[model samples]
Target: MIPIKIPREEKLEIIANIQNHFYREMSDEIGDLAAENLLDFMLKELSPHIYNQAIKDARTTVEQKMMALEEDLYALEKPIR
Candidate 1:
C-alpha cells in the first residue's frame, strides 16, 4: 500500500500539538524537530492499527447498507398469484 501523505498544514499543526502537550502536560520542553520526530514515530508505529480499525468500521458500515438494500429489493418484488 502507498504510504499516507499528511498535508503540510496539518502536519505543522500536529507537530505544534506534540510540542504543546509535552510542555504543558509533562513539564518538558521540546523543540520543533523533536516534536516532528515524535509525530513521525507515531505515524509509523501507531497509525497502522488505527488505519486497520478504520477500514474495519467502513467495511461494517458498507455491509449493513448492502443488507438494507437487499431487504428493500426483496420488498419491491410482486407476490405470485
Candidate 2:
C-alpha cells in the first residue's frame, strides 16, 4: 500500500494534538520534532489496518444499497397475466 500522506497543515495540527496529549496525560513535555516523528511512525504502522477497515465498511454499505436497489427493481416488474 502506498504511504498515507497528510497535508502539511493537517500534519502540523495532528502533531500539536499529540504534543498536547502527551503533556496533559503523560505529564511529559514533548517537542514538536518528537511529536512529528511519533505521528509518522503511527501513520506508517497503523494506516494500512485503518484503510482496510474503511474499505470493508464501504463494501458492506454498497452491498446493502445494491440489495435495496434489486428489491426496488423487482417491485417495478409487470405482473404476468
Where does model 1 exceed 4 Å of error?
none
The local distance difference test score of model 1 is 0.90
lDDT of 1 by residue, 1-81 (tens): 445689999999999999889989999999999888888888888778889999999999999999999999999999999
Clashing pairs in 2: none
Give the C-alpha lDDT of model 2. Answer: 0.96
lDDT of 1 at 47: 78
Task: List model 2 lDDT by residue over 1-81, tens digit each.
Answer: 899989999999999999999999999999999999999999999999999999999999999999999999999999999
Which residue pairs clash within candidate 1? none
Local error of candidate 2 at residue 62 (angstroms): 0.4
User: Cα deviation in Å at residue 18, candidate 1?
Assistant: 0.6
Question: Candidate 2: which stretches are off by over 4 Å?
Answer: none
Worst 10 residues of 2 by lDDT: 1-10
Clashes of each: 0, 0
